[model samples]
Target: MCLIHFQYGEHPIFQLIVVANRDEIYDRPAEPAHFWEDEPEILAGRDLLEMGTWLGISKNGRFAALTNFRDPSLPKRPRSRGEIVRNFLKESVHPSEFIDELAKMKDCYGGFNVIVGDQNRLMHYNNIFDEKNEIFPGVHSVSNHTLNTPWPKVVKGKKRMVEYLKNNPGQVDIDELFEIVMDREIAPDEELPDTGVGLEMERNLSPAFIQLPHYGTRCSTVLLIDRVGNVTFVERTFNSGHFKFEKSFRFKIQK
Candidate 1:
């Protein structure tokens, strides 16, 4: 997932709500979100090339999402960062322990930021940074940099999220949540962040929803976890900004 905008512990109905977009080359082979045949308890889209996932949730109320830390200086590592989310959901481990172990092997992976843990606690980790942070209550976002870094899209998404939640209280509107992440408005060049990517490329990637010709946002996913341990996960896959398919799943947490 390249962009993740979410609310934690602030909403009355759902304790955790996640809206994220996955950006990749259009030709990269990937499947829509589904329960894995091998890891039956895991539900997430699979990266066909690496056999890993960018975001996922498990049967036991555990959920995790990831974003790459954009840095042109660092060379690609031996591992796919997607494996971090995949492995977290596949194993039965505490969040703290998982984060500690990730720190030990941080060098093995490329620059990336991960928001992981179960419903009760979520932690953020970036290999370039030295610490793992406990995601506090309220709206938070993460993209190609650190979490809540306030890039144009992150700020726009978070503002829209807060307003939507504030105005439409009591019940969750799934469509509206999806629409927030579906925004395709490109940020003005003056506001674009200099991530070492050239001005033109940065402008293309500035929007909450990117629609480039060969590379862009491939999918958008919204995950809702209610106080009663009920989960509603919806994912929409696309190709070059054109909608292809959508998958929705709901289940009560095992624990």
Candidate 2:
């Protein structure tokens, strides 16, 4: 499970604020945000050859995320979760329209919760076994459920996010937001959402060192989009594997 906290058009000079966590199995190889020779303009990760990223943003003001819908009973399908992120970054479609397109392809894949947004709009999509839904704008949280499933983690994460937003308001920059999104230390007794892997193995195989690897916050990122169409992006990762995020960069979209 992953969390994203963002505010659009809330700051004086900043037009957008984003903070997110990239959650995945500890063993999955991944690179930090970087531009690949194959995909030059893409800056989040060269070729994230692991699970889909929880969130990403493009210089064109497009942003997206993919979350697995908890379903231990459903049979797994033959699809690449990474493709979801690739498709979103490679395309320039609007969030709502992109979600509509995703719904049509739902049958081709397994259960998932997806969010795509920009400075002007945001949308969510859910495809469980028998139920499906689209989330509307306003403060909302998407975890293993469709959206706001009342799961303890979902509820607590949303509440914490709201409290942070309320207290920080316009002053909530990327760094502060990161602390909130990566706040796994809070409420230690709160049961964490199981990642399908056993707790024992999770502890052993998970990334341990926050700076090197084997277990820790895998990646932290922030994407800002100003009203004038300028974008600022930053990403950091722990460990050395298939992923490595380059230094932060700021750029503008061609009008």
Top TM-score hit: 1
Query: How would you encode candidate 1's per-residue C-alpha lDDT over 138-189 as one tens digit per residue?
Result: 9999999898898999999999999999987688888899999898888998
What are the clash counts of all predictions, listed in order?
0, 15
Residue lDDT tens for model 2, 95-209:
6677677777776667787777667766667766434444443346665556666555456656766676667655446666556555443323234445565665333222211
lDDT of 2: 0.60
Query: Local error of candidate 2 at 224, Å?
Result: 2.2
- TM-scores vs. true structure, each candidate: 0.98, 0.75
Worst lDDT 10-window in candidate 1: 166-175
Error of 1 at 172 (Å): 1.3
Cα RMSD for candidates in order: 0.8, 4.6
Q: Give lDDT per model, in order.
A: 0.92, 0.60
Q: Which stretches of candidate 1 lie over 4 Å from their true place?
A: none
